[model samples]
Target: MKNEVKHVLGLSGGKDSSALALYMSQEHPDLDIEYFFTDTGEELEEVYEYLSMLEGFLGKPIRNLDPDRDFRFWLTQYNNFLPSAQTRWCTKNLKLKPFEKWIKDEYTSQGYTVYSYVAIRSDEDFREGLSSKNKSLVTKLPFKEVGVDRQGVFEILENSGLGLPKYYDWRSRSGCTFCFFQRKIEWVGLMERHPDAFEKAKSLEKSALEHGSPFSWSEGETLDELSRPERVEQIKRDHEKRLAAVARKRVVNPLRPDEGMVDLDEIYGQQKICLACHK
Candidate 1:
């Protein structure tokens, strides 16, 4: 018997991946794509809500590729060191490992060639993606191939009626609640929006630091320090200044001139985005 070919798209509950999925379904409806979300088990509640909303649009079950173990288990294994941007063990052990294991065991081992669809926009370089080392797994960038950039992604989501993730109103990026790539402003946003989740992140950071780990959740300061009323005020003010600076430099888009719009990437500059966590 000949091996089968499979198409899979990963959703991070972020704009890009969701837009890609909508684009693929509209443009390549003939392709039988399997959408999946690799659960970190630490994802924001809004992420799950958005994924559920996305499923309603796709008219397909978005498979949940959950890890066998949770973050606490992995944290213990790593001697309680929190995963930092420099060393994102969370992305590897928690996110990617579950995804890789799922496909390799459930599909590739059964002689299936997995074609993974990534959301690297036309403006984005192919430098960031889950480029598989497995001979059986291949990566595809539909957005880049079709010249779909950031603006195009926005349109796709808007027109699809799926819109952006709810958390985008608070935090632009999607991942675990305590993603180390978060900007100071976003940390303050988390503290304000989801106080409990914020507390959990602080607890994790405290444990990690107690174990003598050089890395805190965010660099330079502890979460406790960041959460201080004075420090939070400073961060908010600094963010407002950055946004004003961006606004001054902004060339107004005649098509959709929403001047108040402030992209996190525009303010802080895009980080080395995690493929598994950020899509």
Candidate 2:
């Protein structure tokens, strides 16, 4: 084993990871940190566009770690089962596998102690399953170490002029356009903003159901049922009602005035996100 270390970071095209890229570049300029994005090929166009803008700011092309097999291939391998919170074959194959392969082939075999910088904010708990079992692969949380919370994440992006991804205007979490982790409201946002992607998801869900897969992209109802005019209106009304309730209960934090802003995660509650794909 060589007495050396490699520093690397992954960008999820979300605010937190993007901000971490900017933060590291500014705070630790001397470290030659390699940045990469694991593309699932099913992501939003806005994700790609935002990453392009990020490249101009970083002055280094973020490497794309494309999986060897596409999503369709994996779907077939899983007998047309759509990945869900209970059965997340999508993240396993499309996100984590590629990164694990790259590190094992390029860095670990080359005898480098690889430090992976993850964007787990200080305010968030150290979620289960984030730790690496491989002795050579070390996971580091700079945000947690430095006490950079959700507020700090925004400040970093705003100061860097990267603001947030365009999808933030409608959708909240970052990952595949049809990520099952999405809330019902986010699915509606997808249907309105990117109908093509929404249709693709609907088609995929239909196929999955026909093949006896128990999971739908959205909980309880299939996309076909969810996309109906009546159901869409019902979802909208429920969303608005929740929003009003949250507004009424919100206590203004003087130190963090922006806390009053409605967070999508707050409305639906934070789901168990894919660490690799989201951050």
Candidate 3:
């Protein structure tokens, strides 16, 4: 007998993917899609909270695909170097590998075709990472198909009462609390909001440096260096300047001054962030 095709959507604990899930639920109720989150075991507390809220709305448990091996295990296997954009072993081993394993064993082994729904918005160009390797594993972008841009995504979340993740008020994007992709200001935000996590990142960086690793958690500085009073003041001042510049560039709608709140990519410039982790 031919196998049934399975529909799946991944939730990254970010606004875009969550909005995409809600949009799919409302717009395509007939499709029984399996929602999943690949937990890194190092994600923020707020990420779990947001996932719980999403589950409440979905009326189903978002499947958790945890790696058999944790971040530290992978770190050791990768020669103790911290994961950076140049060497993102964390996302590969912690995030993407687990998801691929789960789907391969659970769905593909049953000869089922998986149609994975991704949340690439209409305003954003489709990225190379969203592509699937297996012929049977098809990829879909509901937001792009429906013409839902960032504003539309915000509207969906607002109407759904999920709103944005709490970290957005300070930091932006979602992944591990100590994600190396964070801007220096975001590292400072982590230091202020979740000091323990910030300290853990510092310890990791220190160990990596002790082993002669080239990259710091953030560019051009270590977390300990970035957290010093004087350096913190400088980072804050630079962030304020950038925010003011972005705010000035905004043509006020006379209706939405709040729209001036800058995104991480906008302030720090876009990095090669993984959609599976940061979307």
Candidate 4:
């Protein structure tokens, strides 16, 4: 008997993943792909809005794979320690687990050869692709295969009228509102735009510190210290200096005003982006 096959793509509400969905739909219309978003329950409002916009273009509903337990519950499970780059319990529990569970129960266990699509762009290091232990579950990097780099992703979103997510104006990547991978400037952006979320992160960090957790949401200092008026100004100035440096390095296109746009990752130096969270 021929083995059954299933195609699935996960969206992180970031430009690359959203663009991949559009690319797949436009280029390979015959392949039925199941697009899903694994909700951490701490995602920004803009993420939902962007996902909705993507759905309209795809003419299909993207499945929301919400975890059985939310971020708070998982935080408690990890003894209230804030997830850090060194220890990322949040991504495992809040993002990957739910998607894995859904895939295992629905496809793999039923003997389906699952083709999981990931949005690792061509410009990025190929080592960033998410690997699976299951032999039947194959990871496919369509962007890398098709040579769709950062600029190509921008064009895809631009041509599709989906554009980038609204949060792109402030935050570079999309995931939990209080993602630890965020730059100091992005935390500042969060504070300026979503004060409540910033406060919640502060509260969580306070609790974590009180409970003997070493990690702060931001690397060097607590949110309280970071939020001080003078410190905020310092962060802004530093970010501006870095932004200027990056801008000076790039060759600008006069006709395309949007050319050479820089993201937090570009300014802050590239980070090991969370595939399940930031993509």
Q: Which candidate number has the best lDDT? A: 4
C-alpha lDDT score of every prediction, in listed order: 0.88, 0.90, 0.87, 0.91
List TM-score per model, in order. Answer: 0.96, 0.97, 0.95, 0.96
C-alpha-based local distance difference test score of model 4: 0.91
Per-residue lDDT tens digits for candidate 1, residues 34-90, read 999988888999999999999999999999988889999999999998888777788
lDDT for predicted candidate 2 compared with the true structure: 0.90
What lDDT score goes with residue 140 in model 4?
92
Candidate 2, 1-279: lDDT as tens digits: 786899999998898899999999999999999999999999999999999999999989999999999999999999999999888899889988899889989998889999999999998885754766568999889999999988798889888998989999678878999999888988999999999999999999999999999999998999889999999999999999999999998989898887556778778887667778887
Off by over 4 Å in 1: 255-260
Q: Encode model 3's per-residue lDDT on 50-109: one tens digit a residue.
A: 999999998879999889999999889978888888888888888888888888888887
Worst 10 residues of 4 by lDDT: 126-135
Give per-residue lDDT, candidate 4, residue 23: 97
Clashes of each: 0, 0, 0, 0
With a 3 Å backbone cut-off (N, CA, C), the pairs that clash in candidate 3 are none
Q: Report RMSD (Å) for each prediction in the order shown.
A: 1.4, 1.2, 1.6, 1.6
- Output the better candidate (1/2) by lDDT: 2
